[model samples]
Target chain A: MPVLHPEFWRLLSPEWVLVCFGTLFLLLSALPATRGAKRAIGVMALFGFAVVLVLCAQTLAALSPGMHVAALTGLDGQIGLTVDGFSQVFKFIFVLGALLTVLMSFKYLDVEKAWTGEYFTFLTFAVFGMMVMASGVDLLTLWVGLETMALSVYVLAAYMRRQEPSVEGATKYFLLGAFSSGLYLYGTSLIYGATGTVQLGAIRLALMDRLAHGGPAAVGFPLAAGLVILSVSLLFKAALVPFHWWTPDAYEGAATPITAFMSVAPKAAAFAMLLRIFVVGFLPLAPMWTGLLSLVAVLTMAWGNIAAMLQNNVKRMLAYSSIAHAGYALVGLVAAGRSQSNQGIAAVAFYLLVYAFMNLGAFGLVLYLQREGSAGDQMDDFDGLIQRSPLMAVLMIFFLLSLGGIPPMAGFLGKLMIFYSALDARLYLLVVVLAVTSVISLYYYFRVVYHMFLKEGAPNLPAPSAGRPLGWSLALCGVAVLAIGLYGQPFLHWASQAVLLGR
Target chain B: MTIGWILLSLMIALCALGVVLARSPISSAISLLIGFVGVAILYLALKAEFVAAVQILVYAGGILVLYLFGIMLTDNEALRLTRQTHLQAWPVFVLILVLFLAVGHKLYHSDYTPQQPDSLLMVTDQSQVQALQDRLAQEAAAARHATNPQRVARVLYGDYLYPFEAASVLLLVAVLGAVFLAKKEV
Candidate 1:
């Protein structure tokens, strides 16, 4: 019998924190005594996220440079959960995203008349799930983590059950999510049948062994099909084009706070899983998937930017822009595959970090403008915002500029890194598509800016007031976006340290 | 044995078709129950007795009862009217058929034999081959004595303990979500 070491629990302290806080919040939400303590619950949830973030940072600090700690090991010496720079960095991003979302949700939920304790509970649980996804080393563990996150988001999406659009979007999301999960399971089974094991290290060894003996022919068709199916399911989660139909509706219908959360936290976790699975288990098949993903990256960039140009709804436009951003991130992934170097992965990590701040800030501004009985999502809603509220207009411009990759903003640094990595990998065509699509993306992002600064507000429109928590959240995002842009060495170095520890 | 297998597969396929094609919700549900039973029997034939039992208990017993309760509670007229239309059925069927055929062809042609120590030895010396045979026989004997539930328990509690616990967390999230969505007020 194999005895689990005590150190295993120590390494997983961050996840343990989330699980405890999540369950505690779930119980607290059910109690009658806490019925009116909505802000208190949100504050406590934010505190929990802070604690998890610190723990993740501590874990990162504790690891010696170039170290991977296997948190759980089976009898055969298979690692089930790993604590490394990569996982810790992603966990930090997840916790930060959740922290910001909770901070912003306190006032939005009250405004929408949808204050419920379960909102905080699900947020904690969802972050916990994302943490699990960041650390999980086995295929089954990742899938369970993914489902935990997806299920909570589904419920959160439909939290406003009285509204038709919320329920409609949730239903569509659930049906499609279930179908993709089925495909994932089927692909897992096929791969298991082909490789005779599901462990990432074992799968890599099996593929390499097969290739050495039988060349490409020896790997067989089942494994190839399995890889394709798995990639498709993951791509669906990341909201890349062709699998992004649910995104705009879900983003538009979900409460603005969740729209912010969904576009950042869960998407980051999905990218983490993508990098883990592809870079670790499927590295040998890079030649095949790189080509396929490059094509996807091109389609996603062109279609996402083009589609965003046509949207009048600000929420829907951001949805398309988020899709375009995912495309840009995929360029780094393709670069990683081609170069087989740490530079591309580091670029992706940095990009997601920058994206979480700027994208969430953009959505936070939307939440800031939202009033009772008016979603404030239409492009016209931002008209003459400079005349009404100079502070908000300026903040919106900063976020939009950062999102459009303007110089002296964090988003520009992110795009520069990705472009540099892609260029280093000699993916010239992908680089050109990325650059052109970015220019195209600026058109839509600037359209919002123009509405805010250049156009005139309606005479009857009232100036929007931001709640204390929402203001703090937006301030934090704005500061992070600019600070990371101006002084990004430490953050960039941190991202570079998070290298995928392959077998 | 071959004839029994073939007949069982045909019956299962026919029942699946019935479940999809039946217009009445009640009829479709009954077809689903029969289909579940067919799957359970298939598991039994494959010697996965624990899975067979689970297939019957979970799908045929628990889920089927839940379905019946749902059908009973909802308006029959509404259920009939809301029956899903299958406008793209033919195209989807063709796509699935093509995929199935490709997988079947690949599986049939693949070299699926378990790796043997003799293959690694290359020389195939007599004593080594004999030792390999002895070890294989012992393993087979041990496998024969172990019940299906024991094998499942070993895997679930041993190699996959972390994921098994994670799955419990997933279930808890699901329950919480269902309550949050269904409750009239929080």
Candidate 2:
């Protein structure tokens, strides 16, 4: 357990910044006149993210390189929280993702015919949860953060109260999410019983010392069981293969910007938490967990890619694609686990950053196509997209190609680093699976590209009247995807430096 | 005391069985209520007064009423419990068996020591009776009882302050979501 610095409270300003802004937004929603100003509230939420981003940047700046704080210790040496380079990097990602989502939601919410006030509130709270998740060092604190995020997302999915599928999807998500939380809590108890502590840092030290010298063999079975249950809970949150049943329903049922937000922000937070737990805490027992995660990565990719190939609904397809993306990220995680190097963590972080852009851009286009009284997310909706709006077609081309791992798009570079690390770790079988899945993925992705360019039909969809705000956000993501694709070395270096210490 | 625990456990198990076996929603809710009471009693036996009170107040008092209300509002006379075929039952049973074995194996093999309370065990060892009584008296005298409620509050407000604040924001989000979804026009 680490002793608190003199300015330990100041280290938490970014999260409290979110909490204050969320409270203000909550109050803003309580009043009818203010709440009905949908655009204003959404913009306010973006401002909150901007403030948090600035605070995170400042915290990142203040901390010297290699200044890694161990878990915050409280009364009786119970762990409270932590702040490190990895956490700061993830905080930046969460705030940026929230900012982008809010920017996209400004017009999209009104267009979807949903009330806007609580949407912003829930979204901000969800962001807060992500931030909490990034910084949490203890299992209970992490669980609190996870539930906060999950609960908010459940409500967001059912925001379309009048829609039947939306309600059903929300119900399914809530039930499964709650079940997973129970499993997570049970795992926490098991770990506590085994190690006599909930501080992940302490648990790691205990396990390492025990491994170095002889200690009680009494804890091995429960610890292994606990790790399995805990990782299953996280894998469920990340939408990995066997635990991804709720993805399509929730993504399709929720409003589009939310689907984009869900695909990136929460997923990144879960991965960050996983990296912290597995790499920092469970690295000593790599043989126990690495095998299971590798198998999960392979199955997730296969199922996600194959199922995606069969979907006609674009949102549902992207949901499946998101699962496959998580699989790719998992490969990075497993490789990171295998090696002493931080390359795989860096690669996973970079992949999530690029994924946030391309995935959001794709969903942004879906929002553009959506008109009142129609979903506009069907496969046929994309017919003659090039002829109708060449600009959207081109942007969609950038995102779809990126998703397909085409070169000169950021997604390719993301996959390159992950594959490099996997090869470095000698995970040749996973590499083979990755190659095959990418090929299978190309067929579905270009199927969208195929729809836009080749399948000429009556341009009978709503005129691509996506408003100026939505267009600007899409352009930002588009420019990011392009720029990162071209010159990603700086971002790559930053990601490499952002690995958790005390490994 | 051991007998008391056994009886409460029996009530809980039976009530859980009723909750699954009862066909009507009302009966299920009733069984769930009984199960909750048994849980509260079990908590009390462990000397976790705060948790026992909360188990009764929140789970039995609030959530059960909510459940009954939902059942009443969605009342359907024609509704019947669907029967599972042997194939469906077999797979589920196998899964449950696997889970049971896994947990049971850990419980059996691991050094899981049951925590004793401040009260005495009613053992039939005449040779150790005087020592046992003296130990119980010493424990009773040494008990500087800080109740669970006070300890929880102290932890929540002292060491875990930020998480508590974050939890408030979580509740705010929950409230906002409830209004957003449940209301026809938010």
Best by TM-score: 1
By summed lDDT, which 10 consecutive residues of candidate 1 chain A come out lowest?
A70-79
Candidate 2 chain A lDDT trough over 10 residues, lowest sum: A70-79
TM-score of only chain B in every candidate structure: 0.70, 0.64
**For this target, which candidate reaches the highest lDDT against the unseen true structure?**
1
Instruction: Kindly report which residue pairs in candidate 1 clash with one another.
Output: none
Can you tell me which runs of candidate 1 are displaced by over 4 Å? A1-4, A33-36, A70-79, B1-14, B84-145
Which number leads on DockQ?
1
- Report, for candidate 2, the interface RMSD: 12.4
Docking class of 1: acceptable
Residue A405 error, candidate 2, Å = 1.7
In the range A128-194, model 1's lDDT, one tens digit per residue, is 7887788777788789889999999999988888889888888888899888888888888889989
Q: Write the per-residue lDDT of candidate 2 for residues A1-503, one digit (tens) a residue.
A: 13244456566778877888877877887777643576687778878889999998777666667545433422122335667777888888888888888878866676765656678778888988987887776787788888899889999888777888888888888899989989999898889988877766657656665655643353377887888889889999998988999999989888788888999999999998899888866776675578779989999999999999999999999999999999999999999888767889989989998999999999988888887776778988888888889999999999988988999999999999999999999999999999899999999998998888889856455466878778888999999999999999988976776757555
lDDT of 2: 0.80
Query: B77-162, model 2: which lDDT tens digit per residue?
Result: 74563433466888889997897687546433443222121111112244444653475465445444656787667556655665
Query: For each of the candidates, what fraction of the native contacts does it recover?
Result: 0.32, 0.24
TM-score of chain A of each: 0.97, 0.96
